[model samples]
Target chain A: MAGEPVATSAAPVQPGAVLLRPPTNPVDRRAVGWWTVNLLIGFAVPVVVLVVLGLLITPARFWLFTPAVVIAFAGLAAVLALPRWWFRVHRWEVTDTAVYTRTGRFWQEWRVAPLSRIQTVDTRRGPLEQRFGLATVVVTTASAKGAVTMPGLARDVAEEIAERLTVTTQAIPGDAT
Target chain B: MNGDWRRLDKRAVPVAAVTMVGVAFLAGVPSAIGLSGISVGVALAWVLPGAVVVIAAGAGAAWLDWRFTRYQVGAERVEVRSGVLIRNRRSLQRDRIRTVDVTADPLQRVFGVVTVRIGTGEHSKGGTVQLRPVARATGDELRRVLLARVSTSVPADGRLATFDLGWIRYAPLSFLAPALGAAAVGGLFNVADWFGRVEGLVGWAIDLLAGLGLIGAIAVLVAVTLLIGTIGALGFWIEMWWAYRLDREAGGTLRVRRGLFTTRSISVEEERLRGVDVVEALGTRLAGAARVDAVATGLPTTVEDNKADQRTLLPAVPRALADRVAADVLREEVSPTAAVVLSPHPIAARGRRVRWALATVLAGELPLIVLGVLLTEVLLHVAWITAALALPIALVLAVDAYRSLGHGRVGGYLVTRSGTIRRSTVALQRRGIIGWTVRQSAFQRRAGLATVWATTAAGAGAYAIRDVGAETGLAAADAAVPGLLTPFLAPLPDSRPVTDETVAESTAAGEA
Candidate 1:
């Protein structure tokens, strides 16, 4: 249930105004916090299983344990530290005519999608996201890359964005085919 | 019109029998080898019963298939009902039929019938209906009636183009030659292994190679492999394109009839023709030859589908001739691909490619260099040789890729070309472009360039004009598909001072 369409921060102002950077709205601070929780549990389960198997099966006990301990620490460090950088790079904007998303840390990818080509807008909430009161909006175009997903938005915000994208996309003219 | 269901040609039975017999013979080979000690007459007698049983069973199934399998060409749809145990009934809406292709393997040639495949242009498995072994005349008539609306504007049926025997010289230039040759070698080993003698063969070959010494063995191996590859390529070329002829039929359809052992007559509706793609592989480009593929919606894209949708219009012709053919296929005076000189991408694009090439080479060779230093003297020799050869090759390809990046507009089409290994220049109808995607990486942002992708519903679905100036890329996209992207473009920061008049005019235009 959305009211009126609100232009994201990336919307152009007067005809001559410069609006190059995407919207600066960061995801809920809880997203980074949640990812850290998810990361720890995700890594812990697999690492515990692997260590148990290594101790039971392999003869080179020290060799296996050394890498395992090192990997655990490194993984923990990445989970704790990398999300801050990810939070910085991750940005999304929805204009009247298109959707722009800039994300990824090491491989920063900026994608632009003309609203006309968008075939579907899906709002997803997994168990973790639901727990954190967050949702992801996926904009699927006719292109082969499948879709562009912007994660770490409030559930209500994602649903509203999906609704608006659907309305505006439907408003665009049809293709020749 | 036959509203009732009909069966395939009666000749399919004998062809089925013959195929079954051939299969039986192949299956019996190992047993025949085991029976080498027995008398020839005994061996023949032993194998005859099994072959007879297979042929009899196959012939019986073929007869049953002919009886139960039926097709009906109706007013609004063409329906095919098939299968023995599990029934399959597929129907294509008459209006949705995009291609009607007829193919006849060597055995079917003697029987005077062909398999008809009616395609709906959808690349999915369910998009086509195969009518196996129909009378040749019926296939032709079906094709004509199915595509009646397509050729209403054409005055008369005429020949458009035909294969030249001279084109065979370009066969070896294709990557298929070495690829097929390697496959053939691998196949030989596989077949030999089936007889349990692969170990002996490999040992013998290794002994021979060892006698020759490493360098001489390498040289000999390369020479022999190349010889086989070239000959295989030439043979395959003759088999596939021996009597190739392209004709504009009385109705609005372009028909390409080709092949020697297995004949194919594929037709594409004129109404479905959107644009053309000119392809130039590194070897073929070096030889001044190119191929052309059709860009049309509903046409199959899977490699396994009708030999990749049978989209090729001209296979490996002289680049000049291919361009002429591309224009003729589109029924235009000048090929849209040839009418304009493409705009070259920025120097930064070249730098990006060169860095990528070097990175790829380093990724591949680094492990070998490390292993050589740490492990053995033999590996050390290999590492040095690899570096000496790979470095120059990588540099050449990077430069070639940079040279390949270009985009242009010709007539009502937007053309984009790129790639060094498999260069493709697609002339997409400007009207067909449904959307534009502008991408700028952090590095590309610094370099002041962007990749512009024109999205469509046909061909590869999208064609990218890579690494052009950001402003130029956006302007080109807007110009190609007027007004689609203009509303979203953020105005330039410097525009207010430098081009006030133009800015005011653009603002007024935007308001309008």
Candidate 2:
């Protein structure tokens, strides 16, 4: 809400002695709905191919369908459940000094990129994400891992984060030069 | 100041001719032996004449190549003009120069000549220029001139270290010795098979061993293989490191000059160095020896460049001596990594390694177990034997891996040690670390542990302080590169501001 620059400012004070500030904003809720549809379509093509092959190549080995069906259903269940769980666990916070990401449910990873090391900040919108009015912010660093992507944000919010990150990174002095 | 255009040493032509003839003979002899109807004497009658022609042609080509290639050393840049058909002219700026490496193979060594490679540190194509078969003194002079800032005498006293004959003992201890021996054996077998001599050779070997018992035959086979491996390893070590010397030139360049047959003189400018890595292979570690590699930008990371000895600061030496060499290179009293008492990682890390090791060993046994239950009793005995051997080995390795995980700071550098098989202790500059990645799996979260990676532009790019307490990992990372991770962290319930004092205290307490 405040237009004051966070760059060069001290870290946001600890809220009730908590060491880390929880993710400041939630992504667009429609992200889960769009992801579920996308995953189902992605999984369906492979499952269909396997079923057709099983019937055509070895009709006597029809029992192959049992494991295939079980696996396909298991994968579908995970895909269906993951987006919602991801939406819940995935959080990002940008400070003057670094950009932080906390993502993955079963495997929680926290990544921090110092502003000085950032090479570029970008906002990407896939067809599926566009349909849901969502976008992803990707940060490129000097390190070989290339870039880190944070998906599931409103298009405008993604643009705003990208712009702010770019400005902050450029403002920092020393290191790369 | 433009210098006169100079050609390669005159002896290169004859050397080239001899090499061509030798190569032709090596190739022709093998095929001559393989040809079913041709006698050795008959084959040589025709092959020798062809070989003479090859030698003559090779000499003629070398002469033309020498005539076409002329290089001029200028005040500001080095200019090389070469190619008969293409007629290309290339110039490298003196200020942009990063390395000047000299190489001399056995033939070149006989003629007292070396090949000089001038590198500008660019990894892209056309970033290096080569001047072949220069007199060894000329190569040295060129190196001195190119490396010098304002033309000062480089003191011979600047030499920090030289090759030790005792270091040869470490040669066979390296994993490469046995691996190379195995490859050599495989290659011999392959060649024999190709020439249809495999059966004959095996039959001979079998006949020789028939006099001995089966157990004696097996023991003799192993002994023979080991003997061959050790000899190969010793020969290789002598060839690669015979005249090894590390020197700090007056102009602040650190250069390595070594080799027996293919002698190499490689140098890296001091400014490019960001840190050093002290690597101890499992066997070398057990022998209390280690090697030092430089962590620097613009030194090639490409696989081919590794064979060129791009980053080796010191070859295998006593761990203490390697540390001293590292410190000498950095101009520090003691290398930061070796000096610090690195904090041990959480017990959860050990638990994780043990679990993974057990699973891996079990997975290997699972196939044998299933096959045994379904079909054969012999396979069941094999499975039992395999499990009995593998499980203990896996446990020991897991414990070694756990013991290797530690991280600490010494002044301006952050030091982390990890790995069991190729254990590395990297002392990287704090300023060089550009980012941090704090990771926690569900299992790690349950145990309140995390792996924090410090990402930099140098070395393997990311070195991790694995599986420490979540808070400790963050604090160490934050302290290493101050004001980097603090702003991004979510406030914790028991949050205390991670100041330098607290970080120092935590490290002193061994991150316990």
Candidate 3:
């Protein structure tokens, strides 16, 4: 927690200074649904196989086993639904000093890397991310792999963030920081 | 240079052909037996087709080599243009070349031809620009021009004495008993067969020796095994001894020529070498000898049987001359101070030891557990017990993060010594460090420890100092020379930041 994000009061905007705005397009809800569906399929297929095997072995206990199978599938479905709410709470911030990303609700996960420490920045888009017009920017430093996904952002916004981070990080005196 | 670099021994192709045909015949014999069920004549007929295919493939390879192989070295570059169908021409710049190695097999020697291998560092995509079966004199001239152009260091004035291994010095002390025992065992086996032929004479002798005979037979077998192992080890030592040769030429390049049947020569620029390692094998240590190898970058991978990629850059030198060679040829300060350091937490050693112990225990217990389950008819219960037992071993390994690692500065160099069985000690100059990092694992965060690794571009070997105290490691890396290489300058006592005047003066001196 020694390197956690410190609260900063917003600075007054200078008249001639260029002010950058955070992207407004939210991460795609469809991508989240697709991921949830895949997770449920994985859980359900195995459970169905086990139920079929149990029924073949013990036909008289079918009533008892069917309820157990239904309960297990319902529990799995609830777990898959919770991540949608979790993703909504996650946010990413990029400033002059550092790049920060926070995810999760009950157990928060935050990673901050100073601008001077950034080694290389890479922009990657998966098939799902491409469909949603979102990209994940990964910043590799000497210390660790730090990344922030700007989901649902316009294509132009993602490109601008990647270019600006690259230029600023390269200008820093000590590459290792 | 000669453009007429012709084909190697023509006999080699035929020898290769015969070997291929032999293999084909063996393979077809099995299939011929299988086809016999269909018809006896059909099975015999299948062998003819297999023979034809094998002969064609072998002849094709030989014909391609005979048609395509040609290499020529001019003043600027060495060109290897080969391939029968699609001609490939690869030329390497002499200036960019690092080292030239010449090797001669028995066949190549007979033909007065040798293979010249030109090595360029990591960037060279192709295998060593090979000049197959070149004249020995031309090979020598090529080596001379390449070495002159590539090496910028000061060379040694005189040749160093060659190292020799004495038979008495290398022979193991346990040789006699084993040799005698082998002879005795052979005699016993022969004696049993002879007993029937000479029943009256042998039976009388056997009855006299019956009481102590079994004990003598066991002793003989043990002795024979020991002798064979010692003889094998002695043969290796003798080969290593005969191959060792060191050449110190005028300039800072140290050329080492070694190997018995297939000789290999390696050149290392003094400034480029990071360190020299002196390794003592258990057998060598008993013999009061050690093998020394210099750590350098860009050594060619020695391929045996054209299969495994077991390449190493460590060059072996005799122990008696190690210190003097390290001082003279390498031109680096040798410190007597032992820079070896252990991990901060004993956990580093425990991690390796525990894994080995767990593997041994599991291997020993697995069969017993399976047998017990089969006997009791409770396989599922046994499997659960096995899973539960694995949990503690997994936890032990996870918690056993590397610790107690230490490194220190020695004169103008930094030395890091670590590892248990395969102990590695790397020493490199401060100016050589390219970059470094201080990393903390999730578990290390809870334990308040970090590992620091430094990267240097000097040699093939990368120097690393691991699991040192977090703050100390960071400070050590920072205090060493900066990674951004400007030009080297003489230290100015005045604390003014380096100016253009100082840069110009340093460049002038470097030019001079």
lDDT of each prediction vs. the true structure? 0.78, 0.78, 0.53
Question: lDDT tens digits, residues A88-127, model 1?
Answer: 7687778776777767643445566767778779999989
TM-score of each: 0.82, 0.80, 0.57
Residues B136-210 of candidate 2: C-alpha lDDT, one tens digit per residue: 999999988887763345343487789999998888988777777787778889889878899998898899999
TM-score of 2: 0.80
Q: Predict model 3's lDDT versus the native.
A: 0.53
| TM-score (chain A only) for the predictions, listed in order | 0.79, 0.76, 0.59
Q: After superposition, how far is residue B3 of candidate 2 from its true place, in Å?
A: 11
Candidate 3 second chain TM: 0.63
List the candidate 3 regions with Cα displacement exceeding 4 Å. A1-177, B2-60, B72-77, B123-127, B151-153, B157-161, B166-223, B269-272, B277-290, B301-324, B335-406, B437-450, B458-461, B481-512
User: Relative to the unseen true structure, what is the C-alpha lDDT of residue B170 in candidate 2, on a scale of 0 to 100?
Assistant: 85
Candidate 1 off by > 4 Å: A1-41, A51-71, A74-78, A81-145, A148-176, B37-68, B154-157, B183-221, B306-309, B440-446, B492-512
Leading candidate by DockQ: 2
Q: DockQ: which is higher, 2 or 3?
A: 2
Instruction: Please report, as a residue range, the 10-residue window in candidate 2 chain A with the lowest summed lDDT.
Output: A1-10
**Native interface contact recovery, model 1:** 0.24
Encode model 3's per-residue lDDT on B329-357: one tens digit a residue: 44544431133232253233335445665
**Could you give the CAPRI-style class of model 1?**
incorrect
Model no. 1, DockQ: 0.17
DockQ of 2: 0.27
